[model samples]
Target: MARKAYSRRARVTGTLMLLVALGAAGCTGDPAAEDSPDAKPAGGEATTARAEPGKYQTLPQPCRAVETGTLDAMLPGLAQLDQEQRQKAYEGTSSVTYDSDRRTGCRWKVDSADAGHLLRIDFERVVSYSASVSDDARAQAVYGDRMKEAELPLPSDPREEQPERRADDSAKADRDEARATAPADDEAGQGASPETSEKPGKGKEKEAGKSEEPADETVDPSAPAEGLEPRLLRELADDAFIDDQLTTSSSGSGQRTVTVVFRTSNVIVTVEYEVQPKQVAEVPDSASMQEKARELAGLLAERLSDV
Candidate 1:
C-alpha cells in the first residue's frame, strides 16, 4: 500500500511539471523565430518624423510657376524680340540665365526680386543674349529695346470673331430669281387671299425666311471679359503684405503701373511690380476703343468681385 501511494504522488508531480514546461514554451517564442536585423516594421508606419505645418507651402510672391505660363499666354510675340532687348527688360540683380539644352530647347533667364523668395519671373525659350548684357554700357545703350521687349501683349479682342457677310454673285442671282418669280400681291391683301395660288410659294418663302440663319448666342452684357482684373490684382497685392512692412503704390496717368509688397514665412521677400495700359487708346470719331475699355473694365471689376 505504501509503494502504491508513493507511485501516485510521483505521477501527480510529473504531470504538474509537464504542464508548467508547456506553458513556458507557449509564452516564449523560439530564438530562431525572432525578427531579423533588417526586417521591416509590421505595417507601413514610417519611422521618419513628420514634417511641420507650412513646410511645403508655396512662397507668397510672384513665382516663376505663376508668371511663366501667364506671361507666355499673355504675350505670344515674346520669342521674336531681340536678345539685347529681352535682357534689358528682364535683367535684375539676382537674375540667372540658363542655356538651352536637350531637355529644354530654349534659353531662359530667371530673375529673382529678393534672394529666391519673392518675385521670380522666367523669360524662357529666348535667344541667347547674355553676352550683350554682360557690360553695363551695352545695357544702357539698348535700354529702350529692353523695355519694348519686356512689355507683355494685351489680350486679343473677342469681337474679332464676328462673321462677315458674303458678297458672291451666286447669292445675288438667287435673290433676283426669287424676286422675279414672286407675284405682285400687295402686303395687306397678300395674307387675306386664301384662294390665291401663291399661298404655297408664300409658305416656302416663310420657311426660307425662318431658315435664313439663327441669331448668335446671347452674351451676358454684365459679365466680365477674359484677363486678370485690376481689383483682384490689388487684392492679391494686399494679401502679400506682411506685418505692415510693405506699401502698395501705383503710377502712370491711368494707374498703369502697380507696385506691391510680397512676403513668405520661409524666406526673404521684396516688391513686385506690374504694368498695364490704364485705358485702351480711343481712335477719334470711333466709339470702338471706348466701348472696349468699358467692357474690359467691367470684366476687371467682375473678376475682382469674385476674387
Candidate 2:
C-alpha cells in the first residue's frame, strides 16, 4: 500500500510541473517591443489616439500678402504717390500682435484728391487642443460666429414654399408684368411721364448717388449698386461675405467701407477697404470698392495655398 501511494504522488508532481512550465512559456514576450510606440493590438482596439492637427501651423506675414500691383487697384492714391511715398505705401504697417503664429495683420492708408483709402488685412490660424476635434472644425465654429455677426442675407430656399402656392405666385407675377407693359389711357393720349420711364444710361446715375425721390422701381439712394449690397459671396473662397456700409457724418461727408471676410481650412482672412470721398456729395461706388476687396481676398487665398 505504501509503494502505490508513493507512485501516485510522483505522477501528480510531474503533471503539476509540466503545466507550470507550459504557462511560463506562453507568457514569454519581448518587453522592449511590447512597450514600443509602434507596437499595438493585433486584434483589439487602441486605448487612446491623438486627433489630427490644423492644416495651418503658422500664418503668413500680412504686410507682404498683397502685391503692389493689386494695391494700385485697391488704393487709387498709389497712382499719384511719389517714388518714396509709393514704396512706403507698398510696405504696409504691421499690426500690433503678441503672437504672429496665431494672428497677423497689415494696414495701408493713403489720401487722394478724390478720396481717402484705407485697407486692412488680417489672418488668423485656428488650432484645436482636444484630442478628438480637428483644427478645421474649430475654425469652422469661429467662422460661424463671425457669419452670424455679419448678418449677411441668407440664400432664399424656394423649396420652403408650397409648390402649388409658388405656381400661383409665378402666375400672378406674369399677369402683373403684362399689365405694366400696357400703357395707361392718359399715357396713350399724351406721353409717358419722365419719372415712370428709365433711359439706357439712367441706371448709371443711380449707382453712386441719386437725388430722385425713392419710387417703386428706383434703387435706394444710400445703398450701393443693386447687386453689390452687403450680401453673402459664393465665389471668393470656401466661405465668404462682403459688407458695404455707407456712413454720413454731420458735415455730409460720406465714408463707404467694404469688408470681405473668408475662411480656408484652418485659417481665416479678412479684407477691409474704406473709401471716404473728398466731396460730401460723392458717394463711393459700392461695386468698385467691393470688387477691389474681393480681388485682394482672392489673391491672399492663393498666396496661402502656396504656404
Q: What RMSD value applies to candidate 2? A: 10.1
* Model 2 Cα shift for residue 97 (angstroms): 1.4
Cα TM-score per model? 0.22, 0.69
lDDT of each: 0.35, 0.86
**For model 2, how does the per-residue alpha-carbon lDDT over 91-130 read when each residue is reduced to its tens digit?**
9999999999999999999999988999999999999888
> Which one wins on lDDT?
2
- Give Cα distance to truth, residue 203, candidate 1, Å: 94
Backbone collisions counted per model: 1, 0
What is candidate 1's lDDT per residue for 39-124, written digit by digit as tens? 55779565654323312122211222233333342333344557775444333233333442101111223323211112222221
